[model samples]
Target: MTGTGAALTYTTIAGRHRHEIEVRRSRFIAVLERVESQEQADALLAALRREFHDARHHCSAILIGANREVQRANDDGEPSGTAGAPMLEALTRRETADGRTDLSDVAAVVVRYFGGILLGAGGLVRAYSGSVSQALDTAQYVQRERCGVFQVSAPHATAGRLENDLRGAGLTVRGTTYQPSQVLITVAVADSSAELEVFRERLAGMTAGAADAAHVGCEWVDRV
Candidate 1:
């Protein structure tokens, strides 16, 4: 439990959320959506542009990867750093209502309907950042953590009890499968090697060494 797995927790919006604000007669509509990949982010931006073709600018930003290692932003014709940069900053700085921080796998697009009152570069920055912050206020999210995966095999009679014990021991049972002579249980666990060793001991004690789990892979799992 001493690596990134123990140190980082990512925040992700659960679905599409939006906020609209009027500043000096200009309308800024911010749309925030959870996107798993760059392609999806671009597609969503394209759709928003077409959907709001009447808008003057479609400023956008995308944060991808579990660690948010991938990020892309575009002013989309707004002055450099005035629109997209602020929007991205607002997202990266703010946290969800549930308190998760460092938002990732998110795409934010702000469609501006110019009010004819030029909101100079400074004003644009404030408007865009505020627009995203407002949308985040109404968004729902779950915290995500990376976990190692394992598959445990057990006799049919011992499977149910083992599963209950696993859950009781704070392991995430991904799924279960029944075979002709045994049952397979997939579990996702945190990164503590000590905890893993303890789990093996628990398995031995529960089934008298007749059942055990095999390390498989890893994935990002979400929880409230």
Candidate 2:
């Protein structure tokens, strides 16, 4: 599996359970959602807040992008590290919410409304973290693939045939561009150099050595 050219799905813990702990005069509700970007994370948080708008505070934390490019968290009003940090830690625990695995780049938000019970600082940490654990109890997750991007170009006359052949060979076409005399096709191959050789040979044969292809960068793509 290490060098087989197959994309590795990240392993996460499995099970479904929720934990609840009380905080200082507030009850926090944490919901965890696996997301791909800051925008998607924000959208999920917004939706959760709208559903529980009357709550006192809506603290959030998000980690997104293939490289975990964007990471942010807010305490809302609970003492600096009491709310968001704990919630983020809960989400990053590499555990399955349900029975699935391969979780990455996710966001976790904790919503609080005064419960009229002072749970103190220790309680706040436990409560905020517990909320996220609760939401994961029923969440679903899927594996993702890291792919290598490539671009192939050929004369317009051979474009259609080349495209059909590539598809039949199980290559994922990312995008296509048509120019005056040639067609450009962008594709994503599995993340191994060996796979690129196989693709290059097949494409070359399909186009009778007239078409040329080049490699682009690698990107994380949704697994089928």
Candidate 3:
């Protein structure tokens, strides 16, 4: 979580723990899920609230981007820093599931229902933090890759052959557009100029120099 050059791997905690930490008749239920961005975190939080509509508190926190650039936490009316901050910290300390030395964009949400026991400020922190920790223990994660988009254009007659060739060569096809005489194919490749050149050569040869490929912008894609 501290380095600047390491690739990000997604991971969670290893086991589950659920205990009623005293907090003025309220019990915490932490839910952790890997997310790609703040928008996804927001959507999940909204869904959880709706699913558990009668719960008393739905506090949440999210850390996203390669550098963990995007971060947000909400106390949801808990005693100031008691709910959100601790949850964020727990996520930060938790290692990715793959055992890779990479950081990831992740989010965790903790829900609390009043249980009639007062856990005080320290206890509140423990309860909220513990909830996310437990959920992380059982969650699944995958690594994401940052790639570049490329488009290739060829005649309709050669489209099927071109598509099959590209897939056989291990290039990911994002989309394909059909025209009366040609087919436009969109693909994603690793963000390396060398790889692009290789792709071009292979594609040109496959289509007998009848097809030409162009580079588009870069995109963050899920690594398969």
Candidate 4:
């Protein structure tokens, strides 16, 4: 799916993270993990269930797909819309530092230990949402984007300088290949017509119109 203003990108969790909160003597543990498919999400829930076997309730929410089109929530043993629904809302409404709310390919499971006291529906919603939100606040994030690959061929003597200049200009230098007579410097740019044109212009300026870059392919990459 496309992102803001022709740029295709979304925010997602970097890895697995766990956090716990206590409300009215009950313990809520939130586990957040990156999952690319429904099968992976299911595996995550199964593993958590095995890990916290004695928990009173194990509510879960999963969002899978680049556009976050796959959404699933289970209230488990709690009242309808009290646990899983709020947790899913927390995942959907999370914003990045740059104010983007498109978080995808992730799963959240909230395990609750009853602690003898019964909480009302409203209280349960707040506890579930708060647990996931707090865990998200402490998690590391990365951007998943579709990027274009380009190969810039340069002379062996000046290839190093060209690579350094490309990096200095905030381009991702994927790798360098040594050829018989020249070197191929692989670079990645956002996969948009505007961005590709800009890259061509920047390369021309960097090489003084002496070198050209050929578009190779497009790929999705995670950027920190």
Candidate 5:
């Protein structure tokens, strides 16, 4: 119910989303997968290459990083800029909730099965771009959030009641674990100083100083 730490979120493919289309006798199969780093993207490309080895061409484009900062595209023997460029544009220009059109952390691969046809440069561009666009229709996105995680400990008898009370207070309790002498409660909130302060005070009052919170760490987590 407070500041979100000026943290930002980006849009990306939910998981592995696929779509296929035939154009001018050429079959284009597009597969989209979410990836967090260059290594992951490379692995996907390698896997797809082996999976669609029989196809005429296996083109791909990868965009990763919070800023969608990294980009790589390969035409894979197609006309220069015909296959990979258009596909890159299709995925790179996606708009986020805050109006940033730079989509991040998505790997898209297009496999072409030639049907004894020669689609010119223009046609190839359309086919590749269209492949990714169609797959995006059914794609789901997991929003990455910058969250603050903290821990608190309480006596075993009061831990359950404390968790319930924390949840009732509109807190996002990440998890709770039991120990021999006490219980450990972990909670997360928007990454912000204000939110952390609020959490500390709320826990103090709820347990009458019996519960004290400790800052764990911060990272991006998926949210539906």
Candidate 6:
């Protein structure tokens, strides 16, 4: 709930990532995964609990929704504020490659195996925070961008070159469909009038007004 306005883009993990660290002889296994809703986040936590059944603590945090409007955490028997809170901070504070701290749709769980020594409150916070940070370091990142979909129809002879030109102009070419008479190229642009206008103008210039692009709605696209 920290940010307002329509969500245009955000960063998230590409898939599950696991990283383990040892502090004061205790093993902290951190698992980070992409979750789109509360149910998915809960499911991930439940699966981890079952997989690491013998672990001493299964602390977890989840940041779901486009603007990270849903944030939840659980100490799971660990000292208050020592495990889950720090883990959540790691996800919210992570910066994408473009330097945006807008990571969302992520769930993090730290499964701790006791090593016979008790870490102080400060030590525990550092351990959990470091575990998640390390896991993020090794995770593959992707950006979820809101884009307007467009279908551009062109002559079959010019489709290949047109596709390359679109990609070269920094547009996302989702795919191309072949037909007996023409080619249908699907492309995505930022979901804004200004972006769409630019795309149309570019298409006109690229095809000498021979090709036409039709707006085909919008959706969230994943970009690595």
Name the better of 5 and 6 by lDDT.
6
- In model 1, which residue pairs have backbone atoms overlapping below 3 Å? none
Taking the tens digit of each residue's C-alpha lDDT, what string does model 6 give over 1-224? 11348788888898899999999899999999998988888898899989999998999999987778999988999989999999999889999877889999899999999999989999999999999999999999888888888899988888999999999999999999999999999998988778888999999999998888888888888974
Candidate 2 local lDDT, 104-131, one digit each (tens):
5777777788888877788877887777
Task: State the lDDT at 191 in candidate 2.
Answer: 77
Top candidate when judged by TM-score against the true structure: 1
Per-model CA lDDT versus the true structure? 0.87, 0.71, 0.74, 0.91, 0.84, 0.91
The TM-score that candidate 2 achieves is: 0.71
Per-residue lDDT, model 2, residue 118, is: 73
How many residue pairs clash in each candidate at the backbone level? 0, 3, 15, 0, 1, 0
lDDT tens readout by residue for model 5, 1-224:
22443335666767798899999788999999999988998898889889888998989999987666789999999989999989999987766567667478899999999988888888889899989988876787767766778888989888999999999998888899899998999988767668778878888899888778887876666764
Tens digit per residue, CA lDDT, model 1, 89-158: 9888886646656788999999999998998989999999999999988888877877778899988887
The global Cα lDDT (0 to 1) of model 3 is 0.74
Structural RMSD, model 4:
2.8
* Model 6 stretches with alpha carbons more than 4 Å out: 1-4, 155-161, 178-182
lDDT of 1 at 54: 93
Candidate that beats the other on lDDT, 1 or 4, i.e. the better one: 4
After superposition, candidate 2 runs with Cα above 4 Å error: 1-27, 31-53, 96-103
TM-score of each: 0.88, 0.71, 0.78, 0.83, 0.86, 0.84
Candidate 2 residue 208 C-alpha distance from true site, Å: 3.8
